[model samples]
Target: MFTRFRLASTLAEFLGTAALVLIALVLSEITPVSYFVATSLAITLAAIVFIFGPISGAHFNPAITFGMWTARRIGTLRATAYVAAQMLGGLGAWQLYQYLNDKAVPAQSVTFNTTIWLAEAVGAFVLALGITAAISRAVDSLQWAVTAGATYFVGIMIASTASAGYLNPAVAVGLRSWNAAYVLGPLVGALVAVNLYHLLFSPSAVPVKRKR
Candidate 1:
């Protein structure tokens, strides 16, 4: 499987991530729907996972790609490709959202403070860990859904104060196109969160029995 990285799978990863970013931008721009944006994101995540889980592991996020890479679920080269795909996919999504909504500039904001940055870091850590756990089968579908829903809910709640609780660095980069100046605080926070998550919940640290 490591030697074979099919174009279909690669594009699927791109499409899945693209769809998610598109929905997120639309929700953030068309409506200040707040937590509803989180719900939409969660729904998109579930859809992506269900559709592309078997193919490319449906990572769609760089943090997740890092977590899985560290966990030995994927190789370094594939991880790099996956991250590239996710970033490009997110950018593509934003562009498409702009085209559809007829809005040249996406609704962009960066309200960063120490506490807010910490909140973003912690939120991102939890979100990545939750995604890892779900994909790892550490939790059942019901629990996975709950965890994902709650993560987005909490992320959205703290968003206005924390650069919209963006948990993915790739996402931050994607948002940067709309505004040339992107906030560094949340970006650093997100990277720190993923690394911390690896330290806390990496597979080597948290062993499990093989499924029969």
Candidate 2:
């Protein structure tokens, strides 16, 4: 039973991440405006969360998985499995995109500087904040989905000023921008966000004042 559950969760992560990356790659090619692309991706992600949240908690991003693991909400082995599945899913989506287009994915030359890193960090921070809030509040899946989508929409808009605003390590890999700024920035942001949420916002973190 445990093994079966693990397999189910892993497969859910794989499929969810693949769907996200595939849509993102297609949107990048078709959508001319950044607003439209961000909107579409946010909607797509909300749908994914609604569909896959019951199965795998709908992480679909390594940054979220890392945050959960850091908060001790997820086990180490499971987190590793989810991250591996997400990366493979992104790669699989890229392959599918190439096959569908019958052309090579375009290479983008993005310089990674402190500004870009900070932008990515900020994006991930917003995303992580919403996620942790949902978990802490134990909101229903539908509400969580909306919160996730809204956060992604705002995060992408904020990050796109200095970067492509992948905001997701898996999506970055799919888009062929697997650099430190795209990877480490989000992870660091998630780490800080998770810790901050637990330390300052989580219910258990609140201090109870004694009656005077």
Candidate 3:
């Protein structure tokens, strides 16, 4: 059963991340408006979570995997495996996008700055906060999906000005923006977010009243 669960979870992460990256690449290319892209990505994320959350907790991001690991919610081996699978999935999606478009993958670059880093950090914080909140509440899969979608929409919209708003490290890999700002910012933000959630917002943190 343990082996079976591991296989299922790994496969789910690969496929879910692939789907997300592929859609994001296509949308980024065709959509002219950033708001529209953000909206589309949000809906796509909701759908992915609705479908895959039961199998693997729908973690398609390395930052999320890291956060879960830090919170001791997932084993270290599984977290490492998830991160590897997610990165491969991003690469797979990029290759697929190139083939579908019948074009070579173009060189992409972005300037890294404090603003971008801070934006990514803020965006990741919002995302991780929503995820942790949903988990703490033990919300149903549908509610979780909605929460994920809403948080991602808000995060992307807020961060798009200073950064591409690839709040997930896996998505950053897929987008070829694998810079320090894009990568470390989200990881740090998620780290803080998860810890903060557990420290202040988790049920355990709520003080219980003594009998009168």
Candidate 4:
């Protein structure tokens, strides 16, 4: 049940997600800089959140969308649509990266362990927590941009050793071809984060006066 106007929101998500993948893919191909490329991701995500927040809430990641869904910020069907659009963005980025990098970044099969999985979950939780705060108390695009940027900077620094730091499911599917850790860990973390936000910080409902 997408109205024509809502389609723009989907497109915004697509562009933002694809931009992240493209930037990450390109940065990863650079020598030496690839080792500490979280800055690139942080800057790009910050810019996207600032530019596209009004259009789509600047989700750009399925985990964030799922977090919002769990927190009842978005309806289920709309969240599904957003997720679909995000996957497409990832697919587009992967194809573009393959073409540009000559398939240099093939998806590797990971030997998953508890520690890596926990890293993904914890990173995603913190990332989602930042997103929740940005949405809940955002004064302007600048605040959201800062929050998203900081989350990526810290989260990637931690998660990179553990899971290649695919905190965004869009990146997991698009860049890493859907490894189990990339797929499940972030979603679980998003669920936990959203629930925690709901319990601890989300604004409570107020009773309304009935018709007089």
Candidate 5:
């Protein structure tokens, strides 16, 4: 895992993340499916995890990459490379989305307020928590899928009145939007999650493998 994958895991991360943002961009705007943002994300993300979870850990979000790095499950350089790949993937999706739609994607910054900030923070925190737990233990991939999907669902529902449910900074780039709430909330949440897990659940410094 020393940037020495002959298969080039960074490329894999690029492709995997591009696919995820593409699914969200295209599917979430198409009427019936658009109404079910959580459903679309859950299904697409579950499939992605099944396929790329082993390859690049399917970390399509910077927050997830940051969480893994904080937990020492990945080296700093690998994590940085993965994050770059994710941002590129997001950018690609946003470009394609704009081209296909023939219109500018809406700017989606959240209104700043304590309540809104907390909403975004809590949503991101829950997602980071589930992702960290899934990686930490011998949980089923299917279960991981459900837990992650549900976390998104719950988070979105809770923050419905506030943030745009960006939950990920990389995904924000893919969607062609940036909000301080979206960025800071997820970063804080993911950082807390990795540290909290080690402090309370597993104090051992041993890193979890990517495939798990």
Candidate 6:
């Protein structure tokens, strides 16, 4: 059994992630939304922040979780729980996608070229930086929104290749049941991104007391 905060946070992560995947999947399926994919993800992330940021920080992405943990912003126990919840949420999203669509949704082919990997790394680092800065209050609320918008633009643009720009492993898991190939490289890429961000930006590559 989990504590109240942990339970609530897990549920929030699950629902929020599910909604994000659903919206992205639905939108991408209808029209050629690949162009606007960045905007769509940004909107989803913003809404998640509005809804669950106060609760669980709306991680939804394992890379972010891992990065934060590595940066010493989160405790070991809490980080473990967050990672588990994120994985479950991603699996749930995939299942729900199947249930709603009445078929395994065809996943887009995402590949890994050096350029693509670099793009993913950069995207992940930028997104993580934005998130960390926001959490640390280094950036104001308005700055958070601006950061989200810019991060999404950069992220989508970077990952707009055969690989659907997976900057997080949780996202890869969500898409894995549909397309497994998109999982591996992006996970590595995202981890690299987070490590780079920590090395460059964090005071120490260790956890500190989180603001919230």
Candidate 3 global lDDT: 0.87
TM-score of each: 0.74, 0.94, 0.94, 0.89, 0.83, 0.77
Ranking by lDDT: 2, 3, 4, 5, 6, 1
Q: What tens digits encode model 6's per-residue C-alpha lDDT throughout 62-112? A: 777777777676788888888787778777887888898898866555444
Alpha carbon lDDT of residue 157, candidate 5? 60
Clashing pairs in 6: 72-206, 72-207, 72-208, 109-162, 110-162, 110-163, 111-162, 111-163
lDDT for 97 (candidate 6): 83
* lDDT of model 4, residue 129: 83
lDDT of each: 0.64, 0.90, 0.87, 0.82, 0.73, 0.67
- Tens digits of per-residue lDDT, candidate 2, 130-157, equal 8888878888999989998999899899
Candidate 2, position 131, lDDT: 80
Clashes of 2: 0
In terms of lDDT, the best-performing candidate is: 2
Worst 10 residues of 3 by lDDT: 104-113
Please list the residue runs of candidate 3 whose C-alpha ends up more than 4 Å from where it truly belongs after superposition: 208-212
lDDT: worst 10-residue window of model 1: 177-186
Score candidate 6 by TM-score against the native: 0.77
The better candidate by lDDT, 3 or 5, is 3
Error of 5 at 142 (Å): 2.8
Residue-level lDDT of model 5, residues 1-212, one tens digit each, is 45468247788788878888887677557743323876677677777766666667666778878977987888888888988888898889888889988987776654556665677677778777777777676467777777677776766666555666667887767776656677777788778886787768762555567884
Alpha-carbon error at 184 in model 2, in Å?
1.1
